[model samples]
Target chain A: MAALSPPYLLFLGDSDNPLSIKIARGLAHWRPELCIGETGGELSLGLKKMTPAQGARAGAKTFIVGLANGGGYFEPSWVGPIIAAIEAGMDIASGMHQKLSDHKEIRQAAQKHNVSLHDIRHTAAAPPLGTGVPRSGKRLLTVGTDCSVGKMYTALAIEKAMKQERLDVDFRATGQTGIFIAGGGIPVDAVIADFIAGAVEQLSPPADPGHWDVIEGQGSLFNPAFAGVSLGLLHGAQADILVMCHEAGRTQVKDMPGFPVPTLKDCIDTNLHLARLTNPAVKLGAIALNCRVLGAERADKHCAALSEQFAVPCFDPLLHGAGALAESLAGKEE
Target chain B: MAALSPPYLLFLGDSDNPLSIKIARGLAHWRPELCIGETGGELSLGLKKMTPAQGARAGAKTFIVGLANGGGYFEPSWVGPIIAAIEAGMDIASGMHQKLSDHKEIRQAAQKHNVSLHDIRHTAAAPPLGTGVPRSGKRLLTVGTDCSVGKMYTALAIEKAMKQERLDVDFRATGQTGIFIAGGGIPVDAVIADFIAGAVEQLSPPADPGHWDVIEGQGSLFNPAFAGVSLGLLHGAQADILVMCHEAGRTQVKDMPGFPVPTLKDCIDTNLHLARLTNPAVKLGAIALNCRVLGAERADKHCAALSEQFAVPCFDPLLHGAGALAESLAGKEE
Candidate 1:
């Protein structure tokens, strides 16, 4: 999946932990016009921090890394700023699980600067296994109650409020900071537990029952370490809409101390009972939360008491933008 | 994990599918004194068939590949009989997914007969992730309702009926024909979906409190392509006894056509509710089943009607030898 090369430039190696630079705060907050800023950390994302030869003479074209610890290693003082961003011509992506071409000075300076190194959690072939087979589309997903609870910022704020309600959505990405903010996905936890639900059924395939997709979710079927990549991304997301996402007052389970953090009505009733074994009319539809530890009037009274105790549309999709969870999936039941 | 050099020999490569030679009928039915027979298929685990130079002149010492099929490739007509069992001196194991050192003539005939190839579904390091904490001892696992049902032959017949009731058992293995009949394991679907429950919590760690371990189990939380490696091997098998297994008339979900095959009381109440997220005293201690398509009085009246409908002890741990499921886990409650 090497097509990466963007304006990028992030590289926050010494992780001053804003949850280890969440892939440079998810590409400076959702591909801020292909972000050409930020260098090491203090956690800024307020853009302009340059210096990989001043963001390769301000044109950038990829140099990402953007730290995401807990074993997606690749540190050694970020290999001299990634061979000085491959000697300043750029190209060297990384959503790490180590392999900037397994670092021999970033693979001979990206083969003597002809650049290209992507490794966005590596997946090229080997996927086909999952066949609960039903796919037609109109997905949604999100799920979570642990492991960085925001499920990729409530699935990119419900794919930007289902693309401002005109629908036919997309935001699929499944980690490595939503595959470097949707440049591409399927890192389903660096796949290969027999192809995490066949790489989320080849990252949300069969679309167009009025298309939707959305997806992005992982870890936490009461996470005892990535509930089997969240039950193979809920049986390869045969999701007919789920959402859930939680984090408000999380009580344990992030670094998995003793476990806890389940109840968002037992993680939306065990993710709609294992996503009804590959969507038997799955539901849940909303609840996002991540009230960044509350207090916007207690995160709007804990999202209106969990939208009246799980009836549905709860909020805080990064401070309420999933437009009431895209108007409860445009009033579901499709 | 290596260590394989057994009397082995198995091979059965032109797969005449007895479920693709379930790892040479699980090492000729549970390590028939470290098996020293059988060659290419004609389905006979009745032993003595020899010819990898007459099973290395009857001293064998590893030639395994006992076939599994479904993408564990390595076939080009079994690479000339795995380079004629590495030029007959042996050392070659393989629970496929390719890699018999990616066959350059079986890695130059095991580097010109210095032997050793053992890719029992490769796993060397990088495991640590699952920290749902709780590790003490007494684990039991063996889940399933699909994916080669008889979770590793009911966890090797409950570790050979808890070592013929002297207890303090061990077994463990996670796949690749239970790591070629338990010489080693952790191939948890060739790990890395964020380390399938930390490689089954480092293949059953923290032993001694009346030690049990058992473990072996993969794929099937009602199998939508391996319910996330059966929910990360039920939260890294913090199992305080689970058994479950099932097969008896198999309904569906093996080659995944329209799904089905779930109910044995919904796969033991969803594997004791996702194995109580790192086992909050998990239970359902029996019910192995695999009645190999019945008729021993209909598999003992279908294991006495599922042992009086799930009040546990169900049977057929290879036609009744898990000594009443190890006396229902030695009358449980621990």
Candidate 2:
């Protein structure tokens, strides 16, 4: 066999997209020649390059269709076609040459797939994030939706946990919080964008050379329509992992019989299992248990169970015992 | 000063008519040498034997008073008695005996001073607390009140912070919660008691010979009244140092400008000040900042300030960032 070609997978996650990066990094370790591809024009180029490489070797493509990190506005699942087209045999991967055939394929696939993915995000997929929207121009932004527990809390908990371990990190400085407030509560999309601005500004940030700088998207990725759009941006930006959030429990421990508190042992086996069961080999970086339903004890038990059960790390957004989820990935543990 | 005599002060919080052990331990701390005399017939004998020992020493008598931490169920203004007793050269302490008094002079003086002090208990102001029960068989089980941020998100934040630093603490073990239902949730009194039970259990676990324990109380002397019993037990336990919890902001720093993002350097001064403010001669143990209010920025700022301002060690409960709130105190790092 000739020199093995690099395996590229497209990943898209909403705001607070910690899980995506986790999966990306984890996969990087699983195989030596794997590069996570961002969803956008560059991805088109990468996919085009994959063929010649595949002509020389073999190329494989994968992407998370619909991810729900926060709200439902971001669940269009049509990103599959672009990735599939590029994978199948597209010569336009040289750059952003939108062939009429690609548009027809995206439109027809969007209709068949329910959510119109490509038609939505006409704006730059990696929109000068981290930099505030151009001081004067009012441009349409792709923001994540907010439900009960969303991006801010997740970001805060993840960062705080890292700081606990004596790692150096700055959320606004490098990790922008682009919270989209159109849907009421502080929007994580807008917050992330804002953080991106700060990151680009540098502000003499103490970033590590080893860790991958993670940009997370918050809100629902599973909504039938927005999933494709969500995947598009994630793939384009070259995100490393995704942090999925789901509602859980109620008041305290709903049941105790034989359920001696959820522990880290069950985290990955349960959460990661659920995510993958929905779509296997999608490259789930890590698992995050949103256990607001269960009391602290039960949540702890769940996280413990996940950690023990699966090789992948499992975390509870509420308990937040695992410090610095993103910081570790970003590598700048100052 | 023949051998310096017996440097002890027997403290009777309220009355001795009906003895309560909580009050007894309290009195013991105030007057270490006073042979705790029973108000029953045994008192005559007990006091007689104690008198010889007392005579051997100087004129140190049992300091009788009550309601040092907080007021009685009816009138909670007992701080006045404590302030007065301490001012009158009677070492003030925790614990309150029954209110019923036989001495008119004592009653009138106490009433005039609005002091809830008494030397007699309802039953027998004797050694055995149950010696003078009112036939209900229920000895006035002197329950100390506890009322820190009872049942609130803030409390949860405090708990979260403590655990992050690996503190051997159980935030919800007290059966306390901030969630509310019908009649304005569980009574604050019950919440306080439950919380105290958990705190005590965690703080004074099976004492190991190798570990020195650090027990956390409600607030401070200046901000007392978390519960009636803590002071007495603390006194009986001979708590040599007190770690006060003070909010970290403003007062600690002069003309501190707001930062684009919070930092650790801003808030450490306050944490240090509170810890070092322990009685001049008595050693000041570590201080734990309830960093729930202060986010990453504020918490970081305060922690730095605390380290620089006072050589005194400080902790952020939210950060659990320092050592731990519970385990560190219990000396159970291992």
Candidate 3:
């Protein structure tokens, strides 16, 4: 929950897989203005490649670990670069499961230089249990058919489109990458199971009736590994609008073979059924598809077919932007 | 998770509410042979009223803090009693959110006596992520229409009945009360949200084909505050047989004022539907009703009506001893 100082120097930590550097990619794409330079990875953000010292000299306020491996580990090789960043007088912020302060060198360096270390994954104190009490404010939640199926992107896009239309809104991040982009957020997945919904309830508390909290969703309700987190998010969200996000052609849940992705209809029905426990009037606002694998024509056709089938606006938020989806919510109660 | 040494002296901590001492009540009711004496509460377990020193002399190996309040807190008043128990040469086991070791006096006393302090609510290391892959062995899960609707009681009853019938069975606990009764369990709700299912999966690993792991379910899938925990338990359980537990005449979820308790039919349909994600062959073996509020005749009539309605055997597991429900599962695949 540390508020990270921006103008970050992203550290990619030599991860070769494109998926591993998603933290860097997401930051570069969403909050490009806050990014100063890049380090370690061959992959480019079209930003200047600079060492921690050089980036610090160039006015980068924080050094960010922009790599997200499977286990969220702090790799040994990354320690040198992190300490260098601390020596250069830049504070360190990480979304990794391992706390930066747990490392002796980094902890001592940060103490000596008086630089703050932000571990976004670790919550400071236990959040209060969810009361299921209805709170004021309009909220839109982007749910997914599976993990990494564009829930965060769709949420961000909706927030942007709503803002452009002069609607009062904010994108509430629930994951690490989203946290970095938004500068602060509750890492919902890392929270204790009993407090997952409570944490979400705390994160997106009552706001102005006209304001929208476009909450980013987590795992799918069908996913065996994380359905709990997903359901907690749904209950705590108390969303007036739920935007379903799904990949166009993916069949199985990520890394979970033999468990097929739930159909959009099934997803909509289940999410609505569970969400109604907290917010009785919750409704499906739109379908946000990750059509990255499809050609433009095919993606459009797929979206149109889904829209007709589900009787809701459907589009790839990243590809087409969320203007239509935002427009669909124009008539909802303020 | 700590494996508590038995012959316990249950400490009720002066809690007047019967519900608050459910942990002690449950332990005494289910495993009376392991309990030595009781202290500090007017409510009788029909055991001897003995001080910690007297209980220790009577061969108590552990002093159990048997109270479970709204918030799992360590009351200042209970500190002296806990320290007394530790000084009396007994290991201490607590299910409260506050660790017994957190108190300086308690820690020093335990250290001086060389007695272990077990905090059941805290896991030592993170569990692996759930893989969603089906594992061997037959598993039965007891799900509910709301929290505290006798899911644990029903599961324990089934386990006992199965054992009496010379069937291969084990009662797998997931909460603190159940954990104390079962000696050890994962305390699934205290685990990280992402690992709720994973912890369950670890707790009930693959066993012999004929062995049955009777996994105790957590919160109801219909409870707004805890449906996520329920869903995770369902998925990780991969139960071949699900016994639906409901308290008769209850109109709303526990502690949540407005959310209505899901009907038996809705509870069955939804639990089976969600549980099928990890367990496709799952079946509703029986309905276990908590008919404590009804007269014997009325309870029988209620069970009979529900049995005929759902086409599944229905009975109060505690009242009727789960024999019929055990017989209903006689033909399940081994």
Candidate 4:
């Protein structure tokens, strides 16, 4: 439960998956001090590889985090470098669907080194089913235009800004990495199909009326490959307010060819409609744009333009703090 | 794989669940010939039950089918009557979330008696994830007003009607009861959340152009309790045509109070919208009314009125056939 130490070794396994790349990029941009070096095998996908030796040279009290997103890449064969990382007296953290702790060799190595294995997807207790009763709380859910479009990052940013303003708010994580960062939360996608909503319900139980649950979203309604999870999260969140998250200038849904990218309007409308099925009074609170791909000038111009056009507060929370969003949420309900 | 030779001895095991009542009702109404007797221990719900002796005197070839829902109902202590039933040479069938074969005593009893154990929710192959690519063939998914509203029955009826008409059709089940009846199909609810859609996608793969996949639906979008699974099945089915299933005169979502019953129009519209997210051209082909509560004449009149109201074919497949709905699907496109 202790905070993961700094000088972390990020194991990309081959640096092949888009998810791995995203996580690497996110760490490089956000918490570079925690990151020492990256490791990848020969068949890595996105960028070139770096050796395990290079990855571990910085310091010894480091942690190894597997960062693959594709299927079948987390097998036993990939455990050698992970074992080496463990034997080097570094603890392990993994967001991979395949938990590193489940592998015999990895667990043995971690035990020998007396370091812990953190499996983020592992739930502490079985969550109860959703009761469908209306709970009293202000919940803000992040809905995205596509998968891996910064729903988690936006939520984290918003929570950071809210805390800075001394607000009573909590970030409810639903995915693996978010779970890891948050220390404890449901891995919503790993639950049985019927209980996804129930798990979410239990996570953000009723509290004070002013208490805000900033829920992490998954997938997207526009992403054909993962819309089910998206809809599940949307309905389950039962949000009083929603934040539309999008990567600016994306032309298509990820991995799904010929499927057109959803515009901001479309994303907002779809999210509102779906969320309203459960929470009829749900409203779009703001737009947290992921302008990571855009230039500073262009991002600011588009954010301002979108704010004017939609008549809603629009900002990249990482660039422009979520203080404006929090302020707008207080005053803007028209 | 042979058809279960059944003079069924229904084991209710202190039947305290509504799902137990449903499975009993379904068998009593649809497969009366197969059902010989019903047994419930002390804590049974609903109507009174007959003894196991009364159940088996009619015939020797009998199958003891455990009819219960929820957890921990299939414990070792509850295995006595099941063991007796197995000793009496009845092959066991269970639709409980718990598999009877997994119990030590039950497995030993079955082995000693040399009787087969049929776990309806047992999936044979590791089904592949959905490709999200355009696949060939026609698929018709049942979207429902709520859970246990006869979505599975309607799908079975439609497939029956289609097959009777000498059409190339397949009925793909998505829940325990449907899987029991169909002999083989994915148990969508039993599947892990991430793989629910993929299991469905594998169940109804691309077939001949004119071949029809009549996919049984689960849960309902309006039902907050189980909507996650419902939406997953909807997106996964990738149906070109959809049939709306509803129980007549139901005024609210089952088990979840304060949630109003969705109107036929609302159900159709919601289904079409959600289905369109995956299958853009998806159409609500017909309505399969579950008018089990109504008198024959009343059922007929309501069916006729609802058909007129929705401008779509509507019928209780048990009262009339799925013929009209099938016929309407073939002719009506507007």
TM-score of each: 0.41, 0.21, 0.93, 0.82
Tell me which of candidates 3 and 4 scores higher on DockQ.
3
DockQ of all predictions against the true structure, Cα-based: 0.32, 0.01, 0.81, 0.56
lDDT of each: 0.81, 0.32, 0.90, 0.74
**What is the Cα-based lDDT of residue B79 in candidate 3?**
90
Q: Alpha carbon lDDT of residue B231, candidate 2?
A: 24
Regions more than 4 Å wrong, model 2: A1-149, A172-208, A211-214, A249-285, A324-334, B1-334
Best candidate per lDDT, number? 3
lDDT of 3 by residue, B170-192 (tens): 99999988999998899899888
Task: Compute the interface RMSD for each candidate structure.
Answer: 7.2, 25.4, 0.7, 1.6
True contacts kept of each: 0.88, 0.00, 0.82, 0.58
Residue-wise C-alpha lDDT for candidate 2, range A127-183, written one tens digit per residue: 222211112111111112222333334544554555566554333211111111000
Cα lDDT of model 1 by residue, B27-60, tens digit: 7878899997888857787888877988988898
Give Cα distance to truth, residue A136, candidate 4, Å: 2.5
Q: Considering every candidate listed, which one attains the maximal DockQ?
A: 3
Clashing pairs in 3: none
Lowest-sum lDDT 10-residue window in model 4 chain B: B43-52
Superior by DockQ: candidate 1 or candidate 3:
3
What would the per-residue lDDT of candidate 4 be over residues B244-302, giving only the tens digit for each residue? 98899899888888888888788788888877767898987788888888999999899
Candidate 1's residue-wise lDDT over A1-334, tens digit each? Answer: 6457678888877766677887778778887999878887566768888779999898988888867778777878878988998898888888777878877878987898898888887886778888878978678788888877778888887888878877888888887778888887778888788888888888889977888888888777887888888888888888887888877776887677777786778778878888888888888877878787767889999888879987878888767788887866666624
Clashes of each: 1, 148, 0, 2
| RMSD to true structure for each model, in Å | 18.5, 28.6, 2.7, 5.3
State the weakest 10-residue window (summed lDDT) of model 1 chain B: B325-334
